[model samples]
Target: MPKLGYTAAQIRAAEAPLLAKGVPLMIRAAQALADHVTSVLPEPSASRVLVLAGAGDNGGDACWAASFLAEAGVQVNVVPVMGRLSPEPEAGARESGARILTEAKPVDAAQLVADADVIIDGMLGIGAGGTAAGGSPALRGTARDWALAVHAALTENPHPLVIAVDLPSGIDPDSGEVAEPEAVIPADLTVTFIGIKAGCLQGEGAKLAGKVWLEPIGASQHLLGVPPAVTVS
Candidate 1:
């Protein structure tokens, strides 16, 4: 049976209690992401993965996943497009030997995308405007530039598998809108946590989110009685 999809608010509400209780949601989600990434690779240890991390927990999730990938022998390169990352996950990535590309240029981002076997998009999470933390609906600054680089690189070399952590960076998680279409690169697979998001089921979000995979991380019980905002076939 197809699962129901929730809005950002609904998912966040459900996650709150777990987070308050100090559940290791990010780590579990990262493990799931790392497992799925390796599952798709022919030889994971020999693969090169590029991670686009922004200034949010979604970025933290990616950084944690990078640590796992690095430990698994994958060459992981992380670009902090938003100039910051959640401290813990960032440290985990560094400790696991993932290269942190602090200097992010569009040209360099393009080259990284071109060379990657897989690209993990964790530039944003579900939110009303852009991020759950509240920002412009459209990607701005280095994030936009890097996204454009990714779009161009994919256009020229479409070999890399693009994986979105939760939601595609620039798309609205509730409405499925793309305010700046060019700033969002389509994902080959999206490993969303807790629940499927309504955005992934419709509009430009559906197009960008190629395949949706849910990694609930024990949030299912909390969401069990709560009605979903959207359902899919």
Candidate 2:
């Protein structure tokens, strides 16, 4: 059966109460992500996972997931594009012995993407816009550079599996429209939290999001409400 898709606003509303009650939503999300990552790899211990972490909760999820991967003996390297990371995630990554690349140049980023067996896109989430106008100049530049680097590497090898934390960086969670398609990180598989997003099933989303996986994280359907539209069967 096709999963129900919820808007960004709807997911936020559903998560609010759970967060208020002190649910470990981010931790749950990271665990689910790590499990899926292991499922995709032929040898979890031999795989190299590269995470592109932005400065937000989405990045935190990726950082935590990286920690799990590292603990499982996977070679994990995290590149913080936004130059900042949440304290909890930083601690998790540090304690797990994941290599955190604090200052990565363009060539360095490209090399990392080329060497990775799996690339986790945690640069942006539903709340942030992927367009040049919507984001700060530094962020927009960073996303664009990373996307270009990944594109180049894929053109050569096409071996690294790309996994997105939420919706692919630049896609609209509500409309599935992409303001900057070139800058969007295309995903081979996307692990979405709370519920399926409307954007993942429609328009550019269908093409950008190869295979979509939904993780409810204990959120109820009643709390998420009805979606504005459905784009998948």
Off by over 4 Å in 2: 129-139, 222-228
Each prediction's number of clashing residue pairs: 0, 0
Q: Write the per-residue lDDT of candidate 1 for residues 86-194, one digit (tens) a residue.
A: 8999999999999999976878866797789999999988744434436455788888888988888888889999999988888888767788887998999999999
TM-score per prediction, in order, is 0.94, 0.91
Residue-wise lDDT of candidate 2 within 70-184, one digit each (tens)?
9999999998876778888988998998999888755676678778999998888866632322532123766667766666667777778999998787687766787667677
Give the whole-model CA lDDT for all candidates, comma-separated: 0.87, 0.80
| Residue pairs whose backbone atoms clash in candidate 2 | none
Model 1: per-residue Cα lDDT at residue 94: 99
In candidate 1, how many Å is residue 180 off? 1.2
